[model samples]
Target: MKDMLWLMRNIWRSTIRSKILPVYLMLPLLGVFLSALTYSSAEDETVLRIGVANLDKTQLAEDAVQYLDGLSHIQVQMVDLSALDGEVASGRLEGGVIFEQGFSEGVHSGKPGGLQMVSVDGEQATRHIKGLLAGYVNDLDAIARIAKGDETVFAELYNQARSKSVSLSGEMVDDISADQQKSRQSIGYLITLMLFFAMSLAGNILREKENRTYFRVLTAPITSRSYYVSNMVVHLFVMAVQVIVTLLVMRFAFRIDGGLPLWQMFVLLVIFALVAISISMVIVASARSTALATAVQSLLIVPTSLMAGCLLPIETMPAWIQKTASFLPQRWLLDTLHSLQQNGISKDVYLNISILLAFTVTFSLLAVYMFERNEDTRVFV
Candidate 1:
């Protein structure tokens, strides 16, 4: 045990002293943080500049403008009718809602009304505003119909909608709103990508083996098993640096919360990263060559990561793929972290930590067995 501790300290010191580790740990973090910060600041709480051009210029058109301008998330810019397209094209406005001439006359006269929405970017928030304003017009149509003693018909139409809507939780939720679920899903993908650094670390392991330094270590008082234990310690320490860099970048550079209880977040990262470490060990032990290692990493890491909900929301994927993801460690780790964020730490947190430790132990044993039984000349391979 003392020897293991001493070996870990020596290897950790060597890793820290190396000129490459600092650079390897810094540039990627800076890049990730810069991208995240730029994106978050640009997208967050952006008050949409919406132009209102009333060609009709009547009381009803002005009322329409008033209603839209009063709503949240939009800054109504009253512009001249001629500048509507120019403002939209020049990016001064997110979109313009133009009421055609005689809009109120058409409404009072029981004729169709034409409204145009123009924008350079047809983003979601703008689309939602357009939908809301369209609904406002539809409300006018309903009110016009109601004025003709058509109460029975309106009741029947409302009943038809009520009958068609049945919720899973038995609560009649009338609105099917997009609730930024994608942001949380994207969060999941980022978490998976961060943990999946194991593959690169595995590649790091293979590089060390190729350099013949691994064999030189084995020739000292270190046995094959002890050498692997030291490597595991080294891998964990390296991943600790990775997590620190990632967190600092995520917070200061990207300006993201990255979930709550910051210490717990690091703990979750360590647990997830341990699984990646084990997976890397399995990859290194299973592969016969560097070419084989790369190929196997592509095959294993790419597809499993896809299934584990790293690239996209597994909830959106087909049922079979989601079910199959249970076999992947990435899925469990992600699910664990998500559960932690959503519901505080649950029993599943302990289960995931145990499962990851089990995987690490199992893979470490296999790697040791492979190293011991193989010819000394090729044990590193």
Candidate 2:
């Protein structure tokens, strides 16, 4: 016990003095800074300008134009049909809508047509306006069907629809998408850093073996397993510090509202830390030298982390790549965190936690097997 504690203290002291520790700890904050820049640039475009050209010359046509003008985040200007195309093409308007002649007559006959949309950017710029316009046409179609081709009844019913007895009021809900995205991205970067940091700590075993420190320590009363246990303790302690400090900075310092409580985030990250440690152990145990271990770490960690959506979102990847990412423990951790943030805790949280633990156990067993099979005393004593 004393021997293990002595080893643990020594490992901790060596790690604390390393300059790379600060770099690993600060990498997550870089994600936060990038997110801030992205959102700030995105906020510059707040309103959409649209041009409307109505040739129908009817009350319903005017009403449709008024509807487009009344929408939030959109500005509608009446334009001549000849000028609408030029305005949109010249970038004076994002898009344009044209209600052609007989448009109101078609609406009254329940066979609305001649509504056209034009935009340089195709559906991307016009889809929202098209959807809302479709809704207005559908309402008119419904009224025309009920009136049974009688223009007098259609007008009366439409006029009555304009003045309802009940008033409906709407309030915009607070949008937290920007905050959620920033937090998710920051944590994703942190996961990658944690894995790399764990690998660094686990590589200490290899360094000690190469330096003959492991055999020298074994000359004392400590067994190989006790020395490893001490190393694991130090590894977990550093991981905990990384997790706690990063999360604290994210919550209070950056004022990021990730929606989940701090404790939940801590629990999820700690479980992932176990997985990180286990995987690092496997890498260290499998490699015969520090150089080989580093080569393997670079080959495995960055690619797997990228696939697991630790750097970029998994959803942006191809479907096959996304499917493959599910096999990775990092993917499971990130998805679990995302689900908890979006929907709070539920039955599936337990399932995700179990899967993460399963990964840890599987990797740990594999690491033990590799360590036992390794004959190289210069790698793992």
lDDT of each: 0.68, 0.85
Considering only N, C-alpha and C atoms within 3 Å, which residue pairs clash in candidate 2? none
TM-score of 1: 0.72
> Native-vs-model 2 lDDT?
0.85
User: TM-scores across all candidates?
Assistant: 0.72, 0.84
Model 2 residue runs over 4 Å out of place are 35-45, 169-182, 306-309, 312-327, 335-351, 372-375, 378-381
- Candidate 1 lDDT over residue span 65-162, tens digit each: 88888888789998888988899898888788888997765655445386777877766536878787877777656654654545455446534643
Q: After superposition, how far is residue 83 of candidate 2 from its true place, in Å?
A: 3.4
Question: Who wins the TM-score comparison?
Answer: 2
CA RMSD, predictions in order: 7.2, 3.3
